[model samples]
Target: MPYARLLTPLLLVCSNVFMTFAWYGHLKYRSVALPKVILISWGIAFFEYLLMVPANRMGSTVYSAPQLKGLQEVITLLVFAGFSTLYLGQALKWNHWAGFGLILVAAWLIFLE
Candidate 1:
């Protein structure tokens, strides 16, 4: 359980990397044909699903559904923030930080008994 706690979120972080790429990486290559991008994204999505399903399965062993979801959402936000800035060339603004902070607060609340 101790390891699962750490492992689940780590796996999810990796999964989100693939997910972010699958969803947004195409934006960086608009010159590519739409069908080619779709296929490439699909290939990437396969790996995301592979990691995500196990992350959830292992996470479920120690965390509730809402807890897992909240954790995933927070991780997703952080991952996407980096991905967007680095890969998409869009830095997050103050408002985005504020919104992320609010989501963190909400996630904290969800963890309380």
Candidate 2:
């Protein structure tokens, strides 16, 4: 695989990890206050954008925008799955794996010429 192709997925995964926390982690801080949570989320989101922009640029060389978007979605799910399992201490059931497989198929279809 080309370096851009390899880096695209890694960067997408990193970007999603930052985004998931930025968007969802604020719920844990809701007791503190909404504005404070929003500020923190924005701070984290800055990092998400940093990685996401580069990922899209690197991926674009080998993929159309729609294909890159699909690739990001698949990477996002995989990152979320790992984050949920390892950080959130959640169990991934068969249904979740099936859903991921379906997403993978969607990715394949999107990338297919």
Each prediction's TM-score against the native? 0.96, 0.86
lDDT of 2 at 97: 95
How would you encode candidate 1's per-residue C-alpha lDDT over 1-113 as one tens digit per residue?
77889999999999999999999999999899999999999999999999999999999999999999999999999999999999999999999999999999999988999
Which pairs of residues have clashing backbones in candidate 2?
A: none
Q: State each model's CA lDDT, in order.
A: 0.97, 0.87
RMSD of each: 0.9, 2.0
TM-score of decoy 1: 0.96
Give lDDT for model 2: 0.87
Q: Which portions of model 1 show Cα errors greater than 4 Å? A: none
